[model samples]
Target: MRPIGLLTAAALSFLTSVALAAEGKEGMPQLDFKNVLLKSQIVWLVIIFVVLYILLSRWALPKVGAVLEKRAATIAGDLDAARQAKGAADAAVAELTAKTREAHAGAQAEIAGAVDAAKAAAAAQTATLTARLDAQLAEAEGRINAARAAAMGALRQVASDTAGVVVSRLTGVAANAAAVDAAVGSALSARGLG
Candidate 1:
């Protein structure tokens, strides 16, 4: 309750001071149209405003405008430079891409050529081996045939001698070589061995 009374007293004092201050002002000087000093003040305000305007237009404004124009031109030049750089980068990328494609194609062609060469070499080796094997086979067959002919000749002579010996032992007579050869020849032909 004491705090509330103190706050009321402070607010009343503030209000009293504001009222006294307000009562001391006869009126707003700027609104006093009949005062003679108001006209002189207006005249001085116009002269200062005109002087400030002239100074700004002739000196400060022109300098500021030149600075803004220079900044704009620099920005435009930087933008054009960036565009040119981008164009150069794009052209370089295109050139590099073309080179990469060409290199790829060249590598493919080389690979194809290598494959063809390998295939041809393999074919040639196979053909050469086949021909060599055939030649060896033919030679072996010829040797076998020669051995068979020699064995056949020796078997015929042995057969004739055995037959003559058998005939002598059984009949006490020597068989004629020509007659035995003819008999063996007839037997061999009948059995399909001749």
Candidate 2:
């Protein structure tokens, strides 16, 4: 017998002794030692306890243990899946970060290239404008010099005419055109006007 059977037997013996002591004295028929059915009741109680324990050990307890084991396995599987997902997520995040940095660098390079191109275009335009302006300025200077030369030639002719008119009026004789021109030329050369 198991420990539980020993205990049940000991309990049953003590109850029987008590019932015998209180047999004819106690008014409770349930405890009466003269009642032979009490022994059969004790035997039935022991049989019921043993059968119930066997049923629980063979069927119910094993089912409960299987359920617990399945639950533990499921929890472990879920944890492993979560860890794998976290690792994949971390790798994706790292890749995204690297791509982001690469895209930023590419954008920066493109921006710098655009800036350089713009600056070069502007410089070229400035040089072209400068050259055009210089040409225009030089043309203007040449026009001014031409106009001054023409004006000076007209002034020399007028001076010669005036000198011839003065010479004819003072000497009462017609002045020579060749002599007037030579005199004006000499005067103009001396004054640095020729």
lDDT of each: 0.90, 0.93
Query: lDDT per residue, candidate 2, 50-154, as tens digits?
Result: 999999999999999999999999999999999999999999999999999999999999999999999999999999999999999999999999999999999
- Top TM-score prediction, candidate number: 1
Task: State in Å the error of residue 16, model 2.
Answer: 53
Model 1 regions more than 4 Å off: 1-97
TM-score of each prediction: 0.47, 0.45
**Clashes within 3 Å, all models in order:** 0, 0
Instruction: Give one digit per residue, the lDDT tens place, for model 1 in 1-194.
Output: 99999999988977876786688954445667999999999999999999999999999999999999999999999999999999999999999999999999999999999999999999999999999999999999999988988887787788888888988899889888899888887887788766
Candidate 2 regions exceeding 4 Å error are: 1-101
